[model samples]
Target: MTPYDAPLPQAPAAPALIDGFGRQVTYLRVSVTDRCDLRCVYCMAEHMTFLPKREVLTLEELDRIASAFVTLGVRKLRITGGEPLVRKGVMGLFENLSRHLRSGALDELTLTTNGTRLAEFAADLARLGVRRVNVSLDTLKPDLFRQLTRGGDLAKVIAGIDAAQGAGLSVKINAVALKDDNAAELPDLIAWAHGRGLEATLIEAMPLGEIEYDRTDQFLSLKAVRSHLESFWTLTETDHRTGGPARYVRVEETGGRLGFITPLTHNFCEACNRVRLTCTGTLHSCLGRDDASDLRAVIRAGADDAALKNAIRRAVDAKPKGHDFQIARAAAPAVSRHMSTTGG
Candidate 1:
């Protein structure tokens, strides 16, 4: 067995992570790296400073921490980043984590990426037991895409999506609905994804961190986007859920599913079962709240599995019932940290 998969000593069964509000924390989103190949206007600043290599947790440490959560009943783990694929040797982490899937300790292992490198790693990711991926694509227009991403190529992302589908991995197109940018393209984008038998999810622009531009001008409510879509397509609500915040609906015209994540217009914190782990080993119990627990220090302190698990449980215990995310003129973000640092 790999070092990460070495069996742990037998101990009493650890209780599942249930927050104070009675929400079970079954999902964990881990950011492997804070670096990205593209700078989406909504996600990061054009000029960004990333964490140093030593400050970030090693792959072995990430595995141990993730394994502890799995032992505590985290069923799904999503490896995220500014771009997870850009991190060197990331596939090795996937391989190590797949052991959980093999042993039935984990139900799913996946990621959310910019799709800039999916063409190069899709097959390997599929082979490592990743069944699906969420590709963040804001716009399809070549010029507009580059302008929004500050140099991202739309063709490369589309090619990567094709390659991922070719490798038998289900693709979910996650587009951030911006009023001044991709709002008009929502119908076309959803149709394009549905046309390909892919799922399309639109997210309202969240006020996460400081960017070069203001978010108030860009914030487009998914509630309005849904009303607009209903004018053309037949949208019927479905009871489908993917263990994340997005609520799904079946589009009758395209015969595909559509999802909406309205963190601003709609508060979805009532059933929050997920926690975020940054690359530096910080545990954020709530994405919209600034409170955090330093898991990196705990790991580096040479804590045993039991101790690590206790730290995680303590973090979960303090998880807020909901986040207070708001966007307004000349107002700072509700959370100062970038979504990348918090595992988008």
Candidate 2:
């Protein structure tokens, strides 16, 4: 395997979290909360049920789980949300996680945010060992953005992006490509991000939540979008990694690169190196399937760190070789879970 795709060595005395396919799981995506301020039309219902505060994992619990994962060979931790910054005492959580990061236990710590509250936490996050961020923005037009997010302010997101950049954070923008919706504006969004020295990625609309929208109608192909942009700009491959599935490219004449996450067109599960931990403590082995292990149950049962590590090891061993999304819809049902909870 290439160095970029090589299987890393396990820590001394630490169990290697390897799947059936022999892929070593070194990256972990942790959703801090299912609470969000915006109701994205494609993510979930506008008025949805949120977990009770008591149901969510406490800061100490989260820290313990993270430590266990780190001991079991998880090298990178990505903090996700339903807007992770919205959770109470989140900055303290960052400070807590940063301890492991600073002392060399965790190789890297990053975040994927909605950018609504980033303006308030950008500086704190940078100071606390967060070095990179990915902000989700679907459209650059004010009215279109508002309509897409059901009342989010585009100006605020823009200010938040600026704030993230000002804090010396390497920022990237993610735009969900919706057929006949924001499909026409993909290049424009990339241009805007490029002008600001930030790369932008177009992600296909995954069939997840029951949002009163047809996935076939909203799904846009990243391959087609890349071909559309090739008509003008000469694209070249780049080695920069985001620790996810996006294929990054350098666009000539543009100050920044462009990215495409073609999960449908090109599935990367063969080289998949990550698993997700939900805020409520379910460890999802695969995002496109419902294979999960309830970590919260074990913790609440008074399990020690060794037990927690064994639980994570079991989850890794159960990780699916690849998602069956390519199978016919009749044979494989849509991934019913929303991106918010899955930490997509």
Candidate 3:
């Protein structure tokens, strides 16, 4: 283990993080690395150039940044990545962050992964105070799953899900709705997830980065998808919130909860109370907009806790009201950076 494996010193307390739009920033999604085993068509290209190892933040730095947010009244933390599990010694990060949960400073600590390595780490995650996990699985069909993830093994992801549940961690399925790909299979997939007593969330494709495939052709609106599902089943609106962008609904037929993340058709920015921190220590106040602040420089320069807290507050204060996402026949992505880089 690295020197960062040990618990960090307590950060000095700061005022609550409230954005310019009067939204209290309570949730923080930190990307530990921008590397993933799968090459999802919507997320990134098949052959991608990853960041150099030297440019990424150290595990200890990640702990310090996260602790700074906690000191500023952030209650929920979500570890993300191109795939967070792929980062070596990441469990140590989680273990260190669990101290907040034990001290009642953090209400929840979780991660979003592609589930390729979940089977190997689920037990440890549950022990590290991770009560829930979000697994990105586009399809249940083995061949289609392999196609969507570009050589991802469906069986392995399924095994990971089983292991996560076996380890007593609540599992949620996050499937990106694609027009020509898994759109038709969404209902069946929701049913399958419900049958296993797991929540399923469908997300509309966001035009984040340039890919070989046309996003317009791949874009599937959640509005239309919901209309189709309502024809088959009764979806009653529910007042359930997980401190994320998803809007929840209770499926009467399946007796389970389903969520929709519609960045294109609908905007959840008015109630946006979260920010994303990339692996390189760039803090993005708004996911749709590219306004960012560099916290890595502050910490790496040997700046004290007060400087780090000020840097975080500046980012939060500059948060935009909402994102401008649009999809057309021949238009560039709203944001040039990949969703992986932004901690999807």
Evaluate model 2: give its lDDT: 0.84
| Model 2: how far residue 37 lies from native, Å | 0.9
Taking all chains together, each candidate's TM-score versus the true structure is: 0.96, 0.93, 0.96
Cα lDDT tens digits, model 2, 1-344, are 78989888875666678888899988998899988888888787777788888878897888788878887788899999888889889888789889888779788888889899999999999999999899999998999888888898999899999999999998989999987679888888888899998878888777765566666767778888889889988899998876688888998868678888887899888889999998989999888888889999999999987888888888899898887564234332357677787775
Q: What lDDT does each candidate get?
A: 0.94, 0.84, 0.93
Model 3 weakest 10-residue run by lDDT:
6-15
Q: What is the per-residue lDDT of model 3 for residues 252-285, given as tens digits with 9 covering 90 to 100?
A: 9999999999988988899999999999999998
lDDT of 1 by residue, 230-259 (tens): 998899999999999999999999999999
- Model 1, position 67: C-alpha lDDT score: 92
Q: Which regions in candidate 2 have their CA more than 4 angstroms from the true location?
A: 1-13, 326-333
Q: Which pairs of residues collide in candidate 3?
A: none
**Clash count of each predicted structure:** 0, 0, 0
